[model samples]
Structure formats: structure tokens, C-alpha cells
Target: MKRKYIVGLHILFWTLLITNNVINSIAATRAHNTVIDSAVIFKDIMLVAGYNSIMILCFYGSYFLVSPALFLRKNYLKALLMTAVLLFLMTGWRYLLEFWFFKPVLGFDNYKGNNVSVSYYVSNIFWYYFPKYFVYGLLYFSAENWIRNRNRQEALQREKLSTELAFLRSQINPHFLFNTINDIYSLTYQKSDEAPVALLKLSKILRYMLYEGARDKVPLHHEVEYLNDLVELQRIGSKGLANISFEIEGYVGGQEVAPLLFVAFVENAFKHGVLNDPDKPVCIQLKASNQQVEFSVSNSTVVSGTQKDQTSGIGLSNIKRRLELIYPGKHELIISEQERYSVYLKIQLGS
Candidate 1:
């Protein structure tokens, strides 16, 4: 916590304490139905202020010194000894001020009786002061400690989240690059005219991955453009044999989404699903609104068992983990694998 904030809390606590004491003293005087005397009220205020000053000294002595040095370090015997010493000094100081200073100067005494002994005075002071002031000091120390610990935990959680996100993003970039490179290699081996265009598209994709993809979020349309480039690159590599349909249904201009969030699903479709079937081509759709975003990808599955197992690989798992960490309960993901392998994701935007 900030120093100013801690100081403010202390000031507020003391202000409330002094106000309550003054009000209660005035209320007691009014209850007597006697004429309100300004001299008596002033004397009461002076006594309250004088005693409270001693309490403040005792409170901070424990707060900054005894509690941290002895109690916090688990030196129970030493802490008890130190506390007793503090109480003794505070009680003695108050006794002298009341007996020698206030009684003579203002003709006011907190305790009145010729029979009051030394032991009774010390015990009375201990019971009154120790229970209130010392406990308050300990409570204040405990609260500050709790706040410090909670702040530390939150900071650590943020760092862990950032590191995990970066690791997942690293996995995504290379996975897509590996698949794209394979497609380019196929075209280069055949000396296809589309190889140069594919290389240009690859450069654009790399630029996005290196720059935009590294960010926590990017404009929704920027992600859409990245997906478009991926689809076009796949089309060029397949020599018009790849049947893929990509569409957008709502306004994405004002929306911002986590970068590269939808790429895993698209890559999964192209990797494990049938790409050449015109009757059931890879279908990608994204719908957006002011409050939410919905994205879905579906493709015809292969007949082989190996391909079916490959459908649920690192890419899908990585994206699932990312969604859980980033959005948690704000996102819904559904994967259906009966006739067609499909992944649908919906994310709630804003607070």
C-alpha cells in the first residue's frame, strides 16, 4: 500500500476516536440537567486530549517496534516481556501527568480517592489502556500485513498469466508456419506460377505474427484480415482444388480481440479435415456485436482413425487453455465431432 493511504487511515481512525470521546463527555454532562459550564467542558476536553496522546504513543510503540521485532518473529516470551515493559512505561507516564500536571494546573483528576494505592492505580491503568490501544495497534499491523500479502499474490498471478500466454503464442506461430511452409515447398517443387504469390502472402502473415500477434489484443478487423490471408495462401497452394468459405456477418470495426485467437481452429480444420470436397468445404464464420463475438469453423472429417485422433492435438488444446485463462466464465466453447469436426467459440466483451 502507498504511504499516503496508510497515513490517511491512521488519521481517520484518530479523528473518529477523539470525536466519539468528546461527544460522550458532552452527553454525560447534559444527562445531569445542570447548567452547561464552559470551564468544565474545556477541562474535560483537555483531559481527553492528554490521555489520548499517551494512548497514541503506546499504540505506535507497539505498532512500529514491539510487534514487528518480537511478535512477528515468533519470539513469544520476548514479545510478552516487551509488551509488559511498554504498558508499565505508558501507565507511569499517564499517572505522573494526571497527578502532578493536570490535577495542579486544571484542578481535574481522572481518579479521585485518598485510599487509591500504587498497585490499584497500575492495575487500573493496565486494564483500561492495554485492552484498547495495544489491541488496536496489533489489529492495524495485521491489516497492513494482509494487504501487502494480497497485493504480492496478485502481482505474481499477473506475471504467471503473461508468461503462459507468451508460451502458448510461441507454440501457435511455429505451428502455422510449419504448415504454411509445407504448402509452399509443394508449390516450389512443382515450379508452380503461384509459388511467388504464396511467398508474398507468407511474408505478410509473418509480419502480422511478429508484430501484431505479440500483443495481448488487436483490432477485430486486423485478425479478420490475417484469417483472409491464411485462406488465400491455402487456395494458391492447393491450385484451386481447396474448397473453403470464409464470411463475416456483423460490425467488427470497433471491436478488439485477443490476437491470433481464432487461428488455431482454422489450422485444425485444414490439417485434419477434408479440403477438396465442394459439397462440404471448410466453413469459417465470424459474427460480432457491441457486446459479444462468435466464431465457428467446421469441415468434413477423414475416414481414417489416425486422422480422427489427430483432430484433438496441441493447437486445439492450446487455444482452450488460452480461453480459460483470459476469458474464464465469459467464454463458451463447443466442439462437435459426429459427421463434421466443428469448433464454435463465443466471447463476452467489455466488463
Candidate 2:
């Protein structure tokens, strides 16, 4: 993808190709093959190199111009026509180079005293050289398109995932603030001592969502702090009735994670989870060790009739796409849904 590397590879490929041509040139000069003079042999190799150089024009013209600008752009007819025009010019130029320089240097007198003719041009271009150059152009065009298409697909996939991540913020609806205010209002009339703690938790959650959670990376401890505050906020609203448990195990001292990466899973669990169930409560667990992190969240599902999240698939899909983009081969996600919906995620942390 880097320009230097692309150039280096081009140099390397052409170097090998020219080296092979030189070796073959030497082999063709063997006495058993022909008793040609050294100067004539040299002239022949120059002819070969001249023709090869013109073929490279075909290579570049098709790869850079015709293929991308026309072929891959879906102008199939135009691409073919342009390729034919380029081949005519390139092969004709190579013919001129041969007739004027290489043929005279080798003492070939077929066109002596400028007696060049249409029959000779047709014989060399149409019968001898056109097929070889056409195949060369096709090879370069096909190879270039193949590689470029693959790169474009991967880039588009990443772009789509990034757009999904940015869109995910919309899912964090405004209802939380409205409900929290009402909960505070009720608590204030009763003079409940938990109201102030709830407000503090609310402030922490908002501050992280607006500031730290919007950053590219946050200290792992900061994410854990946010998670703790989020769980506490949910518990406060439930008034000791939701039965949510949160725990952290192993070392989490010097790591950093993508901001808000795990928030969707927790939020989905609370939004779709059956909070009033006594036997099946929401459980969230996280562990970090040996340069790896594991997180698992499971919650009971409400009955189909009462479950409100009938069209809430985008959040889970968003997390899956984010995991693919950010962690790539370094993470795995497992989802299970029968009675209780559960998600298990394992990621190798970047230092």
C-alpha cells in the first residue's frame, strides 16, 4: 500500500525479467545456435530490449489508463476499443524502432534505401507481433484490475464499519436523561438518601459518554470506571429490584481500549433484558490477564409479547462490525439466544 514498497516491487519484478532476457540472449549467442558476429548479437539484444520497452508502454497504458478509467468503470466497449488503439500505436512504434535502428545495425537490407512497404508492415505487425503484445496488454490489465478490486473491497468494508461506529452513537437515546430526572424527582419528595448518589453516577456516565468515550482510546481503568458507574446507575433506577451483578478480575492497570467499544453490549442487555425476573438477572463479567481480555454479558429475555426491542438488531451488528474493523483477527465474539440471550467476547489487547 505504501508507494515506496509498490515502487520497490516494480523494480524487483522488471529486474528479474530483464535479467532472464539477458541470460537468454547469451544462450542464443552460443556457436551451436549461430555463428553470428559479437556486434550483430549485441544488435539483436538491443532489438529485443527495444521491443520489450515498447511492450512496457502497453503494460502501463492498459494497467493505468484503460483498465481503471474505462474497463473497471463499466465502460466495457470503450475499454476494448482504447486497448486496440494503444496496441496499434505501441506495436507500430516498436516496428519503427526495429526497421530504422536494429535492422540497419544488423545489416538487414530488406528495406534498403527507404523502400519500406505496406506488405512488410502488415506481415510483422498483424502476423508476427500483434498477438504477443495483445496478450501482454490483457495480462497487465487483468492483473491490475484484480489487485485493485480486492484492495477497494477491503477499504470499502472498513469505511462501512467506521460509518456504522459513528452511527452507533444515535442509539444512545435521550430517554435515559428524562427517566433519570423523574427518578430523582420521586426520590427528592421522599427525601431518599440514594438520590444524590444517583445524580453523581449520572454525571459520571454523561461525562464519559460526552468526553472520554468519544476519544480514540481510553485507559482501561477509565473504561472500567465507566462500566461501574453505568451498572450503578441501572441499579439505582431499579431500587434494589433489578438484581444486576458486575465484577472485574485480574490486572487492569496499564492497558488502553477503544472508547465505548463495550457499551453497546451492556446497553442492549439492559434495554432488552427482563429486569424484573428473580431467577435470571443481568450478569456482566470482565477479566484481563496474559495480554488478553475477556468479557461476557448475559440477561434473561422478556416474553415475546412484552419485549419492546423488535427492531433493535442494528446495535449488535454495529458492535460486530466494530470488532472486525478494530480488533480484526485478534478478537472473537460468540452469541447465544434460546431462553436467555448471552454474548461472549475475547480480545487480544494492544499495548
- In candidate 1, stretches whose alpha carbon ends up further than 4 angstroms from where it belongs are 1-193, 302-314
RMSD of each: 17.7, 16.4
lDDT of each: 0.77, 0.71
Model 2 lDDT, residue 284, Cα: 93
Query: What clash count goes with each model?
Result: 0, 0
Candidate 1, residues 1-351, lDDT tens digits: the string is: 578997899899888998799878878877995777888788778878888888897799778767875545677787788887787788788878888879898997666646567788678767887788888888888887777667755754674566544534453345446667887888889998877888988888878877786676788989898899989977765667899999999898858788787887887777677789899999999999989999999999933222322433345665666677667568999888778878889999864
Pairs of residues clashing in candidate 1: none
Q: How accurate is candidate 1 locally (lDDT)?
A: 0.77
- Cα TM-score per model: 0.49, 0.54
Best by lDDT: 1
- What TM-score does candidate 1 get on C-alpha atoms? 0.49
- Looking at candidate 2, the ten consecutive residues that score lowest on lDDT are 302-311
